[model samples]
Target: MDSTSGPLSGIVVADLSRVLAGPYGTMLLADMGATVIKIESRQGDDTRAWMPPVLDGKSTYYMSINRNKRSVALDFNDPEDLETARRIIGRADVVVENFKPGSLAKYNLDYATIAATQPEVVYASITGFGTAGGGALPGYDLMVQAISGLMDLTGSPETEGFRSGVAIFDVITGLHTTIGILAALREREHTGRGQLVETNLLSSAQSGLVNQTAGYLLSGSVPERMGNEHPSIYPYEPFPTAQGPLIIAVGNDGQFRRLCNVLGIPGIAADERFCTPPLRSRNRTELRPILVDALSTNDAQSWFDLLTEQNVPAAPINSIAQGIDYAESIGLDPVVRVGPAGEMPGIRHPIGFSRTPARYDLLPPDLDADREHILNWLGAESRLAAQSRA
Candidate 1:
């Protein structure tokens, strides 16, 4: 990896986590030029088997978050392999793992053991629940979503609650883990020591709930599923247009007035029932038909263009392909080529640093691809010690 420019240059990370959350977080660090050594099991990370979306018979799911990392497969049952893992951790500036609490203790790879010798190592632990009462529970994203009330809040009121189309909580937890790790690294500079940074999917999911969770805590009201309709905002959901559904998000009175004008219903904005946000939300049943009828006058694309020109936030719902195309059309540059030859395409890291931008110099490794190089590097120190004794 070219670790000469990005902010995390020279920082070495021992990545012991796998699947989504932990891999996602470490990927972010790798993008910023952290030298991440992904220590996988003999069979490799579980995502390596999450197929059906494969590139050249390799799991794209595994490739997505494994870029810019060097893979070293080892079996903890083998003393030599375990020693290699320890040597990697001992030389790392940061260590990230998501094993169940106490699981790594027997192998002496836990935080307490690592910190005993390397007090300045920043260690991060990701879990499904917390380390306390829910320590033993498996930390999967779907389980966290169900347990965190997110599933209860999704879907239409007439239907049973639904899980999000993607692993939303896992992504959110990964982001939280990244944030915590960065914060701990920053603190280490001032304190001259590192501490354990912990994150759980359930807690991240609740925090990601944001306003919905706040509403219940502040008002003593349990929010029910409203489908796409937001609890606090009116004209926030999709409405039928001539061609299809168009989403009109009128955030304030000014936007509402503009939307009304664009829909050719100027009188509706001033109507007492829809004058204010709260009133509009309370009287959505009456307002929905009015907006839907007006929006129906034009095709969804036409209305989207007109409403956007008038400063009313409107959009035609897009598919994943359309979403990426739209981003590219708007010059967002959402994709980048990875690997030494830049032959593989991957999603570009979202952050843009002015002075030190993210780099994509390495490809996702095949299982244990870097074993020879890593073994040689590890052996170098042992050779130096022997030479000194001589």
Candidate 2:
């Protein structure tokens, strides 16, 4: 157990989630010091089998988000186990699940069933689409990306559009779910009643599309794939340097001046055709050759250092390793060692609280790792309730 205190120190989360979206959300809550009980089936979360990146024979995919939580395995088909599952939810302050709509009702673990007994339960449900017309659709990140127009907005116009390197929508949906759950919990403080919070990958993808979605909705303009180019910003994509590509995000005219100065071509910043942001974007065809010519004099690393020192908003394209190294060099310790013995290395929690900080006390568990402990705790609670009634 984590000895550190946090804002959610006393909250208990009954986590019936699996895979990325649901589990990822619960992990955030767990990091914030919730007593997150991860309940898995006999085979465990599907991601546990997504291998080739296993550490100590465990799937790194599964390990990525399951830290700081206790694990319990239960079969709802068994009457005793089903009763125990219900009891755990009954005592929980929050429940996170990603089961298909109507599926959990049979197990008597649906929001309605649990809320009937535990009125203040904050029940969070995650889905692929939603509970309505898309109810039957399978909730996978790639499928949602395709159907939600994310794929159409990714990649270059000349190439077949590609899915993001990671399951972005799933992660986004999980974050949305986390926000919804927290909001519902706060609302429960006033109303004395719990509410159902729901998020789906498709809905999250549409919301995450942000400017692209708004462009289509407000202007009747369909946004298409622009590859690495930004539709509204000039020099926002990577440019070839002497040795490699460097990303230069010139957000405004001021940054443009700074960039031109760094390139030893300050005159380009004053040219009327490329002076302002909109002009630069409009006359990118004219501006690109000039910037590329200037940049070709220096390798990407040299330009990165020179431009960054001048606050020109630039960086050389770095791989995942280099990105982490860069973060570390700047004192953003992005990794943490979890578990009682610090046995596993996990990403550091993103948010920082001055007082009630996030905690990482447990490693990712083996299946049913906390079964005996959880069952004993439930048994103790049952006896207490019996005595109170008597």
Candidate 3:
């Protein structure tokens, strides 16, 4: 696909961030058609070496978030390379970085430094924590999960708190950073000046906690781990069926009524002890066995179909592969082939646009893969500037 066909077609992004959060955000911009130039150190992004899941010796983890971008490696210790890096930032419409706070100040690549000369440039900074007392601490997702109370709310009451299987906070921070960048860009359209857009893992984690945190603040009660059960919702977790586990989510009394009808237990929906949402949630222990026994009458797949047909939210617990297959079976097209030759498999961008669709023309680049092209482009711009001066 042609990059110019995307909504962010004319935008040029300088991506100085590495690893998950930074790269994931920039990849979203690239998906929407920004010309993202990934500036890395000579050693490359730390994720490049993260292995065990490699695609032809390439890091699948790196490829997952670095597609549709060009790579240029520059060492800050080298003055010429530093200058080139600055030039890339100078020419970019948007600059994204995820270094620790103040680390880029010495190199004159911080938002303040860049915004002083190029007030029209949208600068986005992602950090582990904000640039305050927590600035010195490293911002890994696991650490953020523990610090933000997510781990505490994860596992069952008897088990030790567990980290999520994915780097959820990093992903959340990246998404928040992307939204900030887009908002700043929109504001620049009206004001003709850009501002610093900042996001941190801890802050994003707190925001991601959403209702869990809000509930604690309002009621003065700390939430505990429930292991696959939602804190405020009953029948919102997995239940055993004849064949496998099935998830039944009943958000309101209407859904509960529908679910009960589908399970051939319509009378349970009217039971005084489990009538309202609050009552059902409060009396989940008494309600769970009743629902479980009813669900045991059929296989998970059968129950899923019956409940779904009745407009009740239900699903069979699927593995990753099964999930992908399920999405495809429903014509969602969850996977796409990327790379120049379309040989590499990738997850499709989640958003769907009517006028301008996301593109996957480029694959994740090897270290410094596009350095020569980037330098040549920079040189051409310099030549044009000299001519304009002459």
Candidate 4:
């Protein structure tokens, strides 16, 4: 009857954050069978109303990340609500919030308050910036992308700076928050106490930049916008095919040789201009025409099958829907059904274990879907005035 037995099964996460990053972090925990109770304000999460392409007059953004968790709506400023909120935090194993640095202090819901009240709670704080530095800045995914130079690197090599289509910084920050919370949980077993964990969009973006950050710091040179043309790799960007663009990654000389062979143009590998990775990189212009000559012959999938057969890593670029379908076909079960609402499709937890499988819990709750259940469990309704938020 219970399929939920992941490593985090016993953990209960109090999620006081809204929008993508915080909700995304809680979703990750939810995917792993953690009991995540998501708190909302009296007005509900800002994104709950962010719907134009609504499914049955509900926000898709709310559906996207809030699945597999319980939603509790309360006004943090209300004294009774605050007490109830504090009680939840006091019993929680972890708490995730994305409010501004000191915004929660007035309501006595900040990390300090929680840690002081519940020493064993792993309090996770997610923000646009760190609590200390740049804390006052508005935390938004696009703002972080713009400030962190990711936008500058997007789009073509010409016009203006552009944001990534998705909220990459938010997603990455959420991941970092997840990691921090997990790490603190692991360490709590040793010290028998909790700790404060913090992550933000700016830091996550900078950390994610990897070599891009190192290059600027080491070389005193700002990398210009290169579109999809990779900085160090040659002939690796998407190339034209009969159907559409076929992305190829001839990362090394060996891969280049194999790719050339797959194109039925092994002679190209012998050409001095394309003989070595460095040489090919330097002569991408000369090599581009020849590579395109062979690539343009077939569609992306045809070339994808051929290239894989030749032991070269290649894949046809897939849209979101196609990727999901492919993952499901291979038994990954990428989508899961969570409740409080009905069963809605969502991406399963990325990691799996043979011994400790994650719980396939119900869908994300409608506002206070858990209110009656939670109140009944706590026996608070007899002594407390409460109602469902949905």
Candidate 5:
């Protein structure tokens, strides 16, 4: 990213984080123009070895979240390198880490230690669980999905619980961490002090579950899986078309009317059993076969175009490649080239800012690509601090 283009231009982030959650969070800060120094161990971040989807033998998993940041590898066990890390943290505006509870105390890189030295530091810690009762358990995304009741609600009740295809909770926790860090930075503007921010996969997952979790909490009724069917809205799931399945989301009476008109069954919208959304939801079994029969007359894409033209929400399900192509067709530049070589394809960050737009100037760095430069920069900053104190 351009060093001076974003609102966070002058900010420096000491990213002592690893794996998905922490790296993902730091990447957000980096995209926003923070000078994020990703301090990896001597062996590098673990994701570098996560393979099968690699480019030029480099893990795409690692590259996806590590862009717009410089890297420096250091071994905490080495006394000299430990001091270097401490100095780097002591001078950084923000510090992000995902170490387990009390694990950084030996290196004196814990939030308390760094915060004591750099009073205005915004420190963030991501864990599988908080530092309380579940501190010792590993923070794997799959396990958190299972524990957080997400896997239970995912698939049909007839089959065993299945985890989501992606590491959903990790991404949510990372987003929560980014929000916390941004909020902390905002709070620092007024208070002239910083605070320790903490987020975990379990807590984020609970919040992310949203309506399903709320249903159980408010009514004391646990929700179970209903396959592709929505618990509330009728005709919100996919139906078979002549060619392939198409999703028809009939949100309201008008959309329902439009869908019926496009399906050549306008009378279904006025049918007593399916007139209202609640009524349609209550009588889905009666309505499903009619929709199935009507939808079967045309291909998915044909129905998709006809329903969309009539202002009804409908779409032919597309694979990931097709989805990206659709986004490109609509003028959304969803993919970007990163690295100095400009050969790596990375997904663009979703948010848009009119004035302080995100920068994509840097590709993900090689392991310790900026080590010598980083050490020199640290030394210069330390000397400047000493001079100011003297």
Candidate 6:
């Protein structure tokens, strides 16, 4: 891989959004070598102070996605600061923002205005719902989860309407923003001009749940959350053992037969009730207890090991921290370094590109850290002098 010249090396991103979704998108670009100038307001992004577990007095959440980018805190509420914003956007190759639909318009920094000046700039917008009905409301992860029927499918039947602990919609939505920007950049190659790219949480969430949505659409029944059970496959959920429950994914008839072989009940594979995936699924109520009884002979890891060795998709239920650790130990290196914060470590970007892997592990910015530098870059005299120097 040409590490120094990954796909987005010369691209410049003016990140005008705050919090998760927008930041996540820009972080993807930053990782790919885009020079992202994260423009924050005077108070900074609201996430800056949102910390229960602070790292060196800075919010970990704020630092999570701010790596590898320069910070220029411009107060958009002020005319002078607004001028600063225009200057940065004027010089950018790409601009990403998630202002409430009308908010950035009042500042005359909407896509139309941006394209009028930087004709070839890729203007990406992230919204919660969209411009019409949801244009005025604030974009939030939890809100999207609730409104998009995602929360309806997540937890146990008794604890229905549950949401995932992590911000699934936000992360996926950010990825969609990244996709839009990349697609726009590709499109610009032919059009020679920028395009208005829009991505919303609702659309992202709907697409993210493609399989579930397909099942619901095909069956005409709202899928029920069976606490970890597979919606389409049988014996593909948690089965209790002496240590804990294990999730064994018997994907096909071969794996199902092998699972039966593991339990010394290979005859079950020949039985009419458990001969095929559909038959096994129909007999899951009877099969589940039988498998659980066999699985109860060992611990989670033992089952995991046996299943894995036989090429079966099986794992013990692990906590989030354990999962990260597991990913790291296997050379996945999930957590990234975001400079030293009094010995506290920074988080990593999850996206891994073979040709252009993300390299934005720099320190997250402090408030207004790049004011002077940004002001200098935006200065006409400075640009002229810099051009002369070049």
Give each model a TM-score: 0.97, 0.98, 0.98, 0.92, 0.97, 0.92
lDDT of 3 at 335: 93
Candidate 5 global CA lDDT score: 0.89
Q: List lDDT for all candidates, in order.
A: 0.92, 0.91, 0.93, 0.82, 0.89, 0.82
In angstroms, the error of model 4 at 359 is 2.6
Q: Judged by lDDT relative to the true structure, which candidate is superior, 3 or 5? A: 3
Task: Give the alpha carbon lDDT tens digit for every residue of 1-390 in model 6.
Answer: 112455688888999989999998897788788888899887798989898768778898887777777888777788988988897888888999998887888888999887877799989889999899988878899998988888888887888678888899999999999998999999999989988899999889989989888877888878776777777788887888889878888879899888888767788888898888888888889888778888888898897888787787888889979998888878977665554443335555565677776664457778888777667666864568689999
lDDT of model 6 at position 327: 88
386 in model 4: Cα distance from truth in Å?
22
Tally clashing residue pairs in candidate 3. Answer: 0
Candidate 5 ranges beyond 4 A from true positions:
386-390
Query: What is candidate 5's lDDT per residue for 170-224, written digit by digit as tens?
Result: 9999999999999999999999999999999999999999999999999998989
TM-score for predicted model 3 compared with the true structure = 0.98
What ranking of all candidate models by lDDT puts the best one first? 3, 1, 2, 5, 6, 4
User: Considering summed lDDT, which 10 consecutive residues are worst modelled in model 4?
Assistant: 381-390
Error of 2 at 306 (Å): 0.9
Q: Write the per-residue lDDT of candidate 2 for residues 1-70, one digit (tens) a residue.
A: 3344978888899999999999999999999989999999989999999997999898999999999888
Assess the local accuracy of residue 335 in candidate 4 as a C-alpha lDDT between 0 and 100: 80
lDDT of 4 by residue, 152-247 (tens): 988778879889989999999899999999899889999989999988899899999888888999998788898778777887788888888888
Better of 3 and 6 by lDDT: 3
Kindly list the per-residue Cα lDDT of model 3 for residues 1-390, writing each as its tens digit: 124689899899999999899999999999999999999999999999999699899889999999999999999989999999999998999999988999999999998889899999999988898999989998899999999999999999899999998999999999999999999999999999999999999999999999999999999989989999998899899999999999998899999999988888899999999999999999999999999999888899999888889999999889999999999999999999897789888999989999999988899999999988899999998899899999
lDDT of 5 at 345: 78
Candidate 3 yields a Cα-based lDDT of 0.93
What does candidate 1 score on TM? 0.97
For each of the candidates, the C-alpha root-mean-square deviation to the true structure, in angstroms, is 1.6, 1.2, 1.4, 4.4, 1.4, 2.9
Give residue 142's lDDT in candidate 6 (0 to 100): 95
Q: What lDDT score is found at residue 246 in candidate 4? A: 85
